[model samples]
Target chain A: MGAAKVSADHPGIDELFALLAYGEVAAFYRLTEEARMAPDLNGRINMALMAAAEMGHFELVSDALEQRGMHVQQAMAKYRSVLESYHAQTIPSTWEEALVKTYIGDALAADFYLEIAEGLPDEIADVVRGVLAETGHSQFVVEEIRAAVAASDQQRSRLALWARRLLGEAITQAQYVMAERDELVDLVLSGTNGLGQLTEFFEKVQRTHADRMAELGLA
Target chain B: MGAAKVSADHPGIDELFALLAYGEVAAFYRLTEEARMAPDLNGRINMALMAAAEMGHFELVSDALEQRGMHVQQAMAKYRSVLESYHAQTIPSTWEEALVKTYIGDALAADFYLEIAEGLPDEIADVVRGVLAETGHSQFVVEEIRAAVAASDQQRSRLALWARRLLGEAITQAQYVMAERDELVDLVLSGTNGLGQLTEFFEKVQRTHADRMAELGLA
Candidate 1:
């Protein structure tokens, strides 16, 4: 299949960039707040470190938007409602829940960003790729989850269930976003196998999630 | 006066490293937490980005300590009392206060770390220098403080007083650490001209602080 051409006025590109920036900003706030829920100083510091990484990604995207003569705040405001609703509907209630959120949520974002990065112009793609490269939070989540599961069977079971719920909420919110932003949906569906590629993308991600769970003795 | 040579077995080095690591961790925590207090999403995201940079520094130090067969947690525990006391005594109570803390606190740290980085062996020094190179947070602090001061004369006075208090507490804590850790004091004094030079070093820093205050219209 031929690569789909995106115009400069492509609403999908605009919506995607705006949503990505807003997501970064919200991740910064939410992760910093979540860091307080850590059981110990070490855990707290680790969460704080992860939260900070989100900010670096935010700067990259915001700078890109500025380069286009777009006001970041205005662009961010455009997608605030959908993003806020997603987060509000999927609040993590415990340490395990938080870890799952960080782990799965970041993986989904990384996958999508990587795919989108491929279709953008060089400068924009570089920014997106650089932002995606800073995935220390995911590494932390995997380690933390493994350690928690190793500590007890009960903890393992609880976290496994929590991870599933997190996945559900994430998918629900994501579908809402895709439905609302046709341009974004088009951009995502552009270079892929076809319009149905999203389903395949979801399957691949779920397989990765399952592998991670099995590694943690959750499966 | 001749520089005092520090003994290889000097417990003060341990104490100093402990104090330094603890301070880094706390700064990482506070900065990340305070990012939430940003009035606007942009400001909040910037603070969070700054907080994230500190985590990179935190990891560098933590890894360095680990490589030396030292447990980061134990080292942090050793200096918890002094570092926690310092922060508690000088907690910022407002946005202006927070900016002052970031400005004065980060600047002093950069200066001291830069000096120490120069004196250490290549591996250790390289990490410290690498961290010092990332001054986005410091720049943010300077900008925020300058904007706040430019906004109002009263705001400048309040921030000036807050900055002074922060320095006062910092010096008090430094003196306490100096008295308790002769090896570090000796290392610092020896690396430079002498005890006399150490006094001059701090004096130079104080003068710079005052200059910064005046430049901000706070003096």
Candidate 2:
């Protein structure tokens, strides 16, 4: 779980890559599913673009895993059931809800990964950085949510709840991952300044989530 | 309807571009829907890649429409109902069915568009050619179908029926589009050698479809 254990078959790094790689694939499909519920072609196309972006990111991480001699499917197997259940439980009921889920869910996931990336090797960190950087869909989501909320107080309140629910589900899934992948958890905790950084890490994610909510007029 | 009437407001070209652009968007959504039923991560990733390819092609055609001073949404509106009906009537019920539908349906549509492209202006023809050139997904479909058929006769028979149904529904939708868009029909007839070539065109498409089916072991 330290520099002494670092190798091509390092359990911590392998689990991290598997988690991130599978997460990207899951997001790709979920985004496509959400895109189907978009109210118009513009929204639909935007969602599709985001989905394609996720797929591109998935290919990057999966390629990284393959280069390490891990089969992508076998590497991804552990996370599949949990991720599927999380998505099933949190299925968006409307176009607006789907948009909110995608925006909030993706931002939170990105922040979590970015924090974890700080402790990873340069190669892995570089892939995470590249994916996090390609978040051009945020502006579109902000514009959409703001416009919908501006249309009515009822819409605003409904979406605020939706955002909260998205955050809750994401946190629950993150917790599940942490519980299941001890190696990955150890990697993140050790990679940070110390064990104390876990509290600081979560606080940072919360701050960003609140800032994002305020930006969308959901504060 | 003739060469003398071709201008900035040419109904034939406008309708053609509109249909083509909207068709790509529809296919993007349909491909995503089909991808969800994929049997494995590899298959899912492949379907997603195909969906993303359709989206890329959509942007190309939509950009062409914009260059001609037509708004994409407005251009696509005319074909919405007809294309929606086509998809609604031919929803695939399984992975094999989806694959067969995607392969046969896309090939038939490509043949139709290629025939019409011959009768279109250079700008529109170029867009059609680019879109048709992105048929890399066909080989994946062929391999998957052949593997399934080789595994069992029951699965092969089922997929063969699915392919025939997909073809039948596609032809029905094409007829519907022809009946609905008189301008597009006129454009094809006037731009091609004449009405006599329409029969020759369908024969060519049918020939290609038969060859594709044989290649997939569905003959």
Candidate 3:
């Protein structure tokens, strides 16, 4: 899991690249899907821009994976079923729900990638960092959520619940991903001293999630 | 009606811009949705590229609408429902159906825009041309549909029927759009000599659609 094990054929490094590649492309599509749920064309267009950003990252990471001789499809295949089922189980029912899901989901994935960046090779970490740089909340997203929450108490409570549910679902999916992929588990474990640090790492992530929710007035 | 009528307040110009803006963004989302149904991640990523192209046009047309001193929302408002219902009614039932629909639907739109480009002011026509230029069938899409059709007689027939249904539904929706929007009728009419040319215009457009289908082996 350390930079010493960051070669293309190394177990966890490939999995990490595969995971991020699929994750970026998947996010691109998911954001486009959610854009339709936006209240208006402007909202939808803004979401489209965000989706386009994800597409850029997708190309970058997929290109990096290809440079490693890993076919993008072959790399993505292993995680496809798990990610599909996770998305199926956590379908957002409304525009606000979808917005929150994308926000939290992106942040969580970014956090995971950043956490593992320590174990990745220099170039790989740089590419991963480049992808995460765009994962922060867009201004329009914050304003939209804040304005919606300000307009209605029901929206506030409902969105707060949605945020919490997103956290739980994301954790469940992440844990499932870690458990299901032995290479990923090894990659992650190799980086950490023990399970205690990993548990703390997640708690730290949740704290950041709560802070983000607070920023949107959904805390 | 003519270049002389190309102003910010013109009736159909706004509608045209609005319709196009919405159409491009809608295609962006729809293509992203369809990308998921692709047989593999590589296919999905290719669809994403096509979707991204639509997003670029969406931005161009949308920016043009804004420069008209018309709010994009207001410009696109009249189209929101009609396009929504059009999509609602013409929803593609499968990946092949979606592929054919996008391929055919985009070609039809490019034809219409090119047909009407003569009546537009030079600048507006230039913008319209820029957007339509990308409307030509992408090579990958042609290859994909052709491969599918070549693989099986059932796919050939199935996609042929889908193409035909797309043409029908497209005509139905265009008629609805024409009848419901008084300005578009006036706009289309003012650009031409009489009802005869308009009917001829549609027939010509349909001819091109057939040609595109043949190119995909779905004719």
Candidate 4:
């Protein structure tokens, strides 16, 4: 639709879509799996809804990959281990922890995507922008975490520790990803026209994450 | 949109929606949970997408219940144990088994809902019919099961046996429900103009099940 996607010529763009697509599908899996940890039926339903929203985004990006003449599965397979490892290493232990992971993990991904979206071609950028828009279920996670934190000092401190762990795990994985995927690293840096250096870009992301932690009153 | 649903005045209608809504949410949970057993990424994604479709139907019936002035949680709570027990008792041990349970469980529920859909008030019946329509994911299940069965006699025999077990377990719970919920029994019987006796009703359902088994080449 947007210039017929010269995607095959752009390994970086395909990597971008595949990264986004697999991230979404993996999120769908993690959220639904973690729904088991929910303290109540309402909590379980919220996680399931959140998972479904991620699948909705997966479908969008998946279509883009297919239209670009890439096999969705193969493209996604390139990063399955890494992405799944990210979720595996950070399996949320409590309902509050799961909420924190969902909130922080998703916010961090959005910030990273927006960071690189501008460097991609128009078609790829549009697809990225379209699916990155919030599905609004994140607000439920935020409110639930805020309420839980407000309940007790023990709870607040526990989640604060959990959030920092999530952030650390995410940064570790992001660093691993950039080191491994040359195209992705190139794609990310090219979008840094508003930025001066790669360090500044990551600094902005970290600042936003800090703001999110504060919003949850965890900071 | 359809007559604004005079749902509060009709406890039977609320029961119907509650049963359907809880049924959907449970299915959403089960399918996603079972997606863990999927043989490949494709299988997992298929199950996840199927689960998401169930959630979509859940939202429809859930919104319907909320509009009827019923608390969705309280109403759904009525059947939580019974439904959860159904899934807990029949945890599929293999990917093929997961596929079998998914295919059979969903089809059986659909047939039962359609069986009672006719005698309900037009509005409730319409909602039932609307959501009852297959989201088309079943074809994937059927195809997968058939392919697995075609490859080996062991798979064919195992799934056939497993399918009967699912049927028996489902019938036990369903009979228990009819005995417990007077409103549900009355609503079901009310729809029996085309149906002669309750036994005949179940006989028809069984015939359909047999037909489905034949379609799967399992019978």
Q: Largest TM-score belongs to which candidate?
A: 4
DockQ of every model listed?
A: 0.52, 0.56, 0.49, 0.78
Model 1 complex DockQ against the native: 0.52
**CAPRI-style quality class for the chain A–B interface of candidate 1:** medium
lDDT of each: 0.72, 0.80, 0.79, 0.83
lDDT of 4 by residue, B1-219 (tens): 112223335577788889888898899888887887777899988988888888888889999989888899899989988898899989999999999898888888887887777556677777898777788878988888889899999999999999999988888888888888988776666566433657777787788889899888798
lDDT digits (tens) for residues A1-219 of candidate 1: 235644555566667778888988777667767766788877777777777677777788888788777898888887888777767876888887787777767776776677666666566667778766665556667787888889988988988887777667767777788888778788777745466766877786677777767865678
Give the Å shift of residue A121 in candidate 4: 3.4
lDDT of 3 by residue, B56-138 (tens): 78778878888887798777767777766766777887887878877888888788877776676678878888776773337
Predicted complex 4: DockQ: 0.78
Q: Which stretches of candidate 4 lie over 4 Å from their true place?
A: A1-9, A193-195, B1-9, B193-195
Q: Quick one: how many clashes does candidate 2 have? A: 0
Model 3: runs farther than 4 Å from truth? A1-11, A28-49, A135-137, A151-158, A185-200, B1-11, B32-48, B133-137, B151-158, B180-200
Model 1 residue B10 distance off true place after TM-score fit, in angstroms: 6.9
- For model 2, residues A1-219, the per-residue Cα lDDT tens digits are 232223334577777778877787788789887776777778877887788777777778778788888888888888898888778988999888888888888889889988887767777778777766665776888898899899989999999888888777877888788878888777777677566877777778888999989999999
Error of 3 at B212 (Å): 1.2
- Model 4 chain B is weakest, by summed lDDT over 10 consecutive residues, at B1-10
